[model samples]
Target chain A: MNALNRKKEETFKPLGSKSLLSRMAKYRFLYLILAPALILVLVFCYLPMFGLVIAFQDYDIIGGITASEFVGFDNFVKIFTMPKFTKAIINTVKYSSVQLFLGLPFPIMLALLFNELRMIRFKRIVQTISYLPYFLSWISVVGMFSAFFALDGTYNTFMATIVGESYEAKNILTDAENFLGILFWTNIWKNIGWNSIIFLAAITGIDPTLYEAAMVDGCNRFKQVLYITIPCLLPTIAIIFIMNTASLVTLNFEQVFGFQNIYIQEETEVINTLVYRQGILNAEYSLSTAFGMFQGAVSFALVCITNFIVKRVSGVGIW
Target chain B: MKKSFGEKLFDVFLIVFMVLMCVIMIYPYLNQLAISLNDGTDTMLGGITVFPRKWTWSNYDTIFSNESLIRSTVVTVITVICSTILTLIVCVGAAYAIKKKDLPFRNAIIWILLLPSYISAGVIPTFILFRYLHLMNNILVYILPSAFTFYNVIIIRTFLSSLPVALEEAAYIEGANEMQILYKVILPLCKPVLATVALWTMVASWNDWTTTLYYVNEPSLFKLQYIIQQIIKQSEVVQKMVNDSALTGGSTSVRARPTSESVKAAAIIFSTLPIICTYPFLQKYFVKGVAIGAVKD
Candidate 1:
């Protein structure tokens, strides 16, 4: 296959300068097809990347980047000294750790349990309903939850019946004690089904003959899963784990923003919201941009570390 | 594959647990549906669980009659359609060009495109750039920024690259120009992938309100999700009002406002119903699409 491909490549190579110009002309048509996409990426993505330099400057709206005074590390100093920055970083790490360590295992367990079901039709139905929340907007999810958890909401009504009339109804949304629970559980609820798909696909790729062999060896359902299924799933798990680790500094902005309120702001504020508040709402562009840069640098470092770890462990890396 | 008594019992337990899981998943939406159909005043008393006690369409009527809601619904539909087309054009074009083995700087272009997925310019600089582009409060803000989705481009490129190259070579031998080959031969074979990408784009565009939250302030440009968010916020205010009055033991003087719970529920239903209704049909393709897109790469 390698030789054939190389031979085909050789046939297409233009040798002389005249033929090279013609070859370039032919490729230019392909370039034209990609121009609009290229230009859009350049304008929106790459240009804004260069705009990160404003992190070092005292950015002013009227003067813009050109006239803004460069304040070597002053913006970073301001972010470090800000009261909310510490809380924001702590909350970001707290929620993401719970999401990664506590929340990541649920989907894998779900897929494994799902694979054990003998009823095929029932499995499909369960999957269909379970994935419904994945498609709903965060705003819709927050709306539904807010309504359900209201003071006189359905949740309170149900709780009264279960735990009796003596059960006091504290509004779940505003209760600082319940904020981490809400974030963790809601993140699991919203994502478990979607994340289960990868594991389920991996399960399907496992050879049936191995399962049969395990069964013949007196391996029970639990033993078969332990011996055959989990081993088969490790490569996929490694890839996803590394990718997720690379993104630790980032949280879903919409999810955090959707459920945010003044009462729960103490517990729920994250780094992204801090940036949003400082940059857009407070108009402190330089300080917030510095925070943004810090986030990027940390995430990039994490990606490199995780990539190295994954490569050592599995001989496969994302890059 | 015979099961022992213990295994059979375990299967029964699993089925029951799965059923409960499904119930828990759907219960919120079901509760919201009941409230949306119930009378606004009646809902304040609570205990409206799975079905409405005093059924009414007043909530739906209020939503349908609201000028901003109607306008935003129009905006959402237009935005989804326009952005889906733009995304397909950009993604397909870029993917097609990158599929060529001889394209210059192909790896560099691919790396540059994937940079956004890793590092970001955050809200401030991107917001500033959009403002400078005059996309602020403009409808184009919804359409233009989403055109170059790097993941979708990679998905399509992978799909295109995996196809048999002989078909395109045959087309070239038949005197087909590159454009003709792309449109007539290659694209026709790419229907499944294109449809999947289109569906994903549609769902994303329909659900997006963040663009409006950051870039738009004009009422004319508010999308349906943002309007639903506003309604939910209003309901929160009313809930606070009730809570405050209850704390003061003035429950007799205060009553549920007409737009408090039921109207908000109705707005939630309005925003979610279309996606839910269309989901089952798309479900068959969605699983495979995501699996192929994520797992292959």
Candidate 2:
């Protein structure tokens, strides 16, 4: 006979003689502390989740969730058949990989560099300069970029003189050719410093004893990094990589929407952005909902696959 | 002791690379600053370089002259204040509750609170929910919908777990109630980590445009981020129209003269200056705080 091992069952069983109500009374204030926040979380976060049911139905604004016609596979079918949808799905995968691939390594490198520093002030300055952009919204960063890169922008001006005067910034995002790289690089530029933070933490968590031991063994700084630092960071690197893989299908929609234009729409489009444009902008409720649900499904699959792999390999996973 | 050639070379390389990157990073901002100071022929500021061809303070003057900008700044400040307070209150409460070893329904509530981050219910459903709750376009709409995030809850919980139980017990024995302990003993000692969380919450709430974009269309309620976004979108629309008109030889020409691009840029720099200005104050903790949340596994 198998029974579920749940917390509620465990809690009551251990202190069986005590009345459940009285036991609750004993810790009443903790419950009181939690009550307002718990209610808010329930009402705002958990409740909105119940509305995911619309994914299974043909949602109508006027008709609402109840009156909406129920058609499951049809919505999913439209999503798969749509060209833009496929592009979005592919773009999301490619962009996330680009982000994780190019974006993931620098932090570990920085952490190693930072940990090597004997001079604290110089290290602080480097860290400060590096993470400056992480605080700015995507909007601000993009504004800064477009100002210098537009048709008459400095970047194009520099290129125009060198390349016989044909360069332009305005067409970069709209050219269908150069847009994806622009989006990818812009994202990297914004996040590189912020991403380095975790690696620094992992490095700092390492025991100084290891370094002292390595130093006593006459291992040079480079050798110490290769042997001691990199190996210590492996677990963290593995975890971040797995999490990145899990979210590979969910690109940052808000950032993409802010930066992308119509020409790049086919190339730079992502599943999240597609959901917004199709469902919210175009008012194709069922189709967008289906695409969103499909995205969720893919991300879930990715997360599970990552969890399995990480669990097997490193004995660590998000779950 | 004299430094070796290798060490000297490495240091030189590091400084050059760092300074070069800093220049690349600040170049765009310097360009924006130049545009803000330029007027007349530079009014368009279109594709202007790292320096203004025509320089004046009129652009900055115009921005300061906007009553709406001033009002929105005040509103943004108030929201940042309130949202940071409310978020810290809820986050500290929930994190403390979750940290209780014997608390009833702890794990269940923790999972329930966090489950929202991973799952996507789609935006329409969320929009409809907000609509139903009578929160659509309300000023509270911006603060309430995202008052507590699961990601934040997890981080604060992690920090709280590292707190010693003996301290809380000592406070309890001294006749300080749970609230008193949270405020006096736990909170005051939590200052460093609290400062980190406070900085993040403020920056995030200040930079947020998604909530405002979806839930609101009112100019009066537009946060700086949303205002900058709308202005950019308008400029993009105009840019697109101008191109279309030029292609078809349509009789219409834009009198706005591509100034929207520069204006959008100006608006962004202005909106962000406050948060960006605080970055130096909190920069010390960025590495530490992110280091914690970055490795959830």
Candidate 3:
């Protein structure tokens, strides 16, 4: 009996371990398909993250990652001491907060206003035209703005006709005082049309019977919007608001970078521009990496807090 | 419901406001068109509103006449096509793998891929790494960096996961392999999301100029948007030169009346025309795509 049991155990030994291996082997081709993307993410995305440790070191180009001496928090100290870095942080916060406070409601308002339109053809036309600018590259938009705002350009001519004073046209883009306003309003202009899309979808999704009941109760269009439409739109609005708040620390690098020039650099410079200048132009690897890590930490905290508040309040969140 | 006087007045006000908004939206492009078609010298006289004051194709002629424009256009075409196709393949494959529930290390792979979207290594580390790899000035710079847009992958994954699992189950029962079930059963059902991803990839690749602004110093590899940007910058510089010379009363010997204005306008139109034309069709999918992408878990 003992000899027979020993022969059975020996026979089953290879099959026991090989079964798990075989299950994974069955999905081998799928993994093969995913190999290229995995490699790209590792090389392009994950490797740079490992490279992020250079933020702590006194990163040197000639010595590379291995030979760089450890500096602890020196890079962060340097970043905090640099006046330009502080200005960039302040500007970024200022621009983002203004955009959050002022620019958040325009799209929803636009969506509601458009929904009130009875003429379908005209509504479609308005939507099409509104969406057109969203497709234009920032370079193109900045170019157009620069040309129109030139001293001898059409804007000045039109102003001359209206005000009858041929004072030189204001270079609004370069004016330090108008920088935040310009950024906010142009963002609204470019995105309001596109941003209203989800709101429109939400509006359409609301039951028509709610409006019918409101009408039976003698509610005017304005009252209907206030009582019915806004309440129904709040969930969508809450989600969007929370999502946007999460991104409040980050600016669109291309949008600001394309519009930037030496004249307006002081007013328009933000964290991204700072990173670009220090990292690419000056090759201050450790300092710029530290700055990026700082921005990332702040942004991550903001997103987490917003997500928590939103989840608790509205029962919907980014997660 | 019968309309009240207030309702009628409100409708009128709304219509007027919408019409005004449309005009504001369209006038910029139309203004550029008018300036581009007008004689470059005449455009300097100002007030070319919706239509050209003096019509000519010379601005477009000048832009097309440049050899760099043609080369850039060709380069743009090659990059957009190659990059879009490559991105779609990479994203779709990974998204497919991620859809499988029992795949080994699936959660970890997902976390790694999605990490970059949230936390960046900043410009310095990425630049140094890419330079080390010698990807600068190479066409791979455009294609490889964007090979996996994790956002698009998430969108596609959400779509694939939402699909009924029974279809794939039946295929598996019928002795189909994983690849077969994916290509034959799953892919056919992924049209809407696929279209959305494709259009997005195409638009992004076509519009990108920052890659060139950062890495490409070789004129031969200049993309269309980047070259157009250079033209706009040159025109601005020459415009400044012309303005300065005129101010100094130095008898500015200008060549061809500084046709830079109309040329820049023409370049704007040239670059944006294709996107404008393609927008209406893709608009159908994007509205739904964005909503689904945002609201889904």
Q: Which candidate number has the best TM-score?
A: 1
Interface RMSD in Å per candidate, to 1 decimal?
1.2, 2.4, 1.7
The DockQ leader among the candidates is 1
* Predicted complex 3: DockQ: 0.58
Sort by DockQ, best first: 1, 3, 2
- Give one digit per residue, the lDDT tens place, for model 1 in B205-276: 999998998889999999999988887766664454334435545333233334468778988999999999
- Measured against the native two-chain assembly using Cα atoms, what DockQ does each of the candidate structures obtain, in the order listed? 0.66, 0.49, 0.58
| Worst window of 10 by summed lDDT in candidate 2 chain B | B249-258
**Distance from true location, Cα of B208 in model 3, Å:** 0.6
Docking class for candidate 2 = medium
Please provide, for model 2 over A1-319, each residue's C-alpha lDDT reduced to its tens digit, 9 standing for 90 to 100: 2355576677768677566567678778778877767787778866776777777788878988899988868777777787888888888888787876777787677667667666788767776777787778887777777666666567776777788756443546456566567767777667766677787778888898998999899876678889998999888888888777756888776678887765566667788887887876787777776787777778877878987988899887777
Error of 2 at A63 (Å): 2.2
TM-score of each: 0.93, 0.88, 0.91
* Number of the candidate with higher TM-score, 1 or 2: 1
> Against the unseen true structure, what C-alpha lDDT does each candidate score?
0.85, 0.72, 0.82
In candidate 3, what are the lDDT values of residues B45-118, reduced to their tens digit? 78888798777776665666566777989998899899888988899999999888888778888888887776
Chain A in model 3: its TM-score?
Answer: 0.90
Candidate achieving the largest lDDT = 1
Candidate 3 structure quality by residue, lDDT tens digits, A186-228: 7888889999988988998899999999989988889999999
Q: On residues A201-308, what C-alpha lDDT tens digit does candidate 1 reach at each position?
A: 899989999999998899999899999999998888888888888557788888888888878876678888888887888888888889989988898889889889
